[model samples]
Target: MRNINLVLMLLCTTLPVALSLIDGLVPNGDFEEGPKPSQMNGSEVVDPHSIPHWELSGFVEYIKSGQTQGDMILPVPKGHFALRLGNEASIKTKLQVAKGQFYSLSFGIARTCAQQERLNLSITPDIEGKGWGMLPMQTMYSTEGWDSFSWGFFAANNEVELVFYHPQAEEDEACGPIIDVVALKSLSLPKTTTDLLKNGNFEEGPYIFPDTNWGTLVPSNIENDHSPLMGWMVESLKAVRYIDSDHFVVPEGKRAVELVAGRESVIAQIVKTVPGKTYDLEFYVGDAKNLCEGSMLIEVFASNSTFYVPYESKAQGGSKLVLLRFKAANDRTRIRFLSSYYHRKSDFSGSLCGPVVDDVKLVSSILHA
Candidate 1:
């Protein structure tokens, strides 16, 4: 009596494959995309008869013929995880569910650059640290294309997470977030299974407060010396490549952030304390026309041992994505990336070329999840 049906697909790599299929992994090795088994006639994808509630980690890579937004090309967790990145396509997957059963989350995206593709669609709340919080479960956008779009969320938490906000435009083409579908099914509590994660009824698009997401998801740098926190892109306490020049060479043990180039690097870093409690040291600041233009707001004082944050130079590149609410005796101190607290104390200038920080995520000033 556990027919937990799950259908994961994004087909069209040109095949004759078919079915409610399930099971696929290899998230990313970059093998062309989808449709294999000698090239066509099905060599895979076809194992679903409803029996998986949810379980898909990340990267399985596949996008043959290219229509799907590749990432777990086949890791079947049908209980739900659609998010093809609609503004879609850069690759993202996150989950942490576990409740009394009944899961169904959804968010089908589509983007070509609907006016700069602000594709900045955000709504966070899968937070799990403040007295039972699960207040976000809303999203469904896809007007039609490849006719790929589907949404259906109703979770009580076996777990939950699906954050994919895209805005790395310069010519764009992470291609086809064109999700074909997203699934999740588990319902059998005629009396106690009705909260389907209640209060998550949909409709709350626009709360980017996660430090503005820094230039959104960058590339095309101009340089304020770099620091939309560069997603905490660190290195150089000893140096070798961690030599972190311009700070956007990402690849040191991943928490994940990709957007590189040279000429304006520094990008902040520091989080080795938790004394007297006063945390909320957010990060963000972007600008670029060829090298800085506008935006840079700083505030990191752990006893006034250091401070710096001045970014201004713009034709395009945005994010002060700021958020600093402090009160501390010491969190172990340190949060810097040059600007050197105006070095001389305050005449700090501009054009250091920065802007590009991805999910440096740290919300525990008092614990929200």
Candidate 2:
């Protein structure tokens, strides 16, 4: 009888876990319900109860589809409703999460009535001061339409609060970015032999809108250790420009790291590998600006091996992928991409031309015998 009772208790405990995994934790994240046409004017706030499943604070506007407000036309990314948070306004929702499990948060955001729109996102009870993360500021010219952004964080508590608010806004312009299509899902860690580099696609970084439209790494004036590229470091004489799909032909997703801002530049990432094992290194190289007069060169260094590959911008319009095989002599190997070629001093831009790199992947090539 005791064993049967124990079996029943185990079944009860596991059923909830199974159900939670099948359905998302966020309720009404698509904003398909409970968004009345906001009658409030400038700086006027909305009631929290009006929007079901969302806790609102400060001034916010709930706009239905096809609604227009102050030169801003509301278009839903998923359903017939969306949310617009003004400056100093915030929206939050409590979600059930497995403690210490990895989860990803993704949503669609669009700028409205402002140029440099910025938002602060956090999953609270702050874990090691990483609870607060900034959504890369957006600009009018950066995205053609609504763009989806995603981020990953570890759940520190069984119940976590997802909070988003505008951190900065232009003077007198409080209405910031429009948000919709929020999704939160549990994530599984990659296999031990898989590539362990974070932000290998260069998709995670500080996007400085308007000025450069992306993050640029200037050696003498390094903004921060990891702003443009999260898990990489820039060691160069001048600067490394962060290129986006809008301006340049990105090899993979929407962004790539250019090796030159003014002169020679280098980007490196340290990855863990089993010593005495062979690993394969693969990456894409191309011309970011397509304005170089001569051949662009890229030097790749993995562990104890170094190889130089040249690419012609005029011949190959887009990026080309290259693979290199090397043996890991140490537990930690520093994979480096260096642009050493210097353009002629009189060639208009004065040694400012270099190669672009993206879609970097490093994986074990041979299994241990």
Q: Give Cα-based local distance difference scores for all models.
A: 0.29, 0.65
lDDT score of residue 318 within candidate 2: 72
| lDDT (tens digit, per residue) of candidate 1 on 34-118 | 4334432222222211113322222211223323323423221122223233222333333333343222222223333233343
- Error of model 1, residue 270, in angstroms: 8.8
Off by over 4 Å in 2: 1-20, 23-25, 36-45, 69-72, 126-129, 138-142, 169-174, 194-269, 273-280, 283-321, 325-331, 336-369
CA displacement after TM-score superposition, residue 56 of candidate 1 (Å):
20
Candidate 1 lDDT for residue 349: 30
CA-only RMSD, every prediction:
17.7, 8.7
Could you tally the backbone clashes for each prediction?
52, 0
Worst 10 residues of 1 by lDDT: 198-207
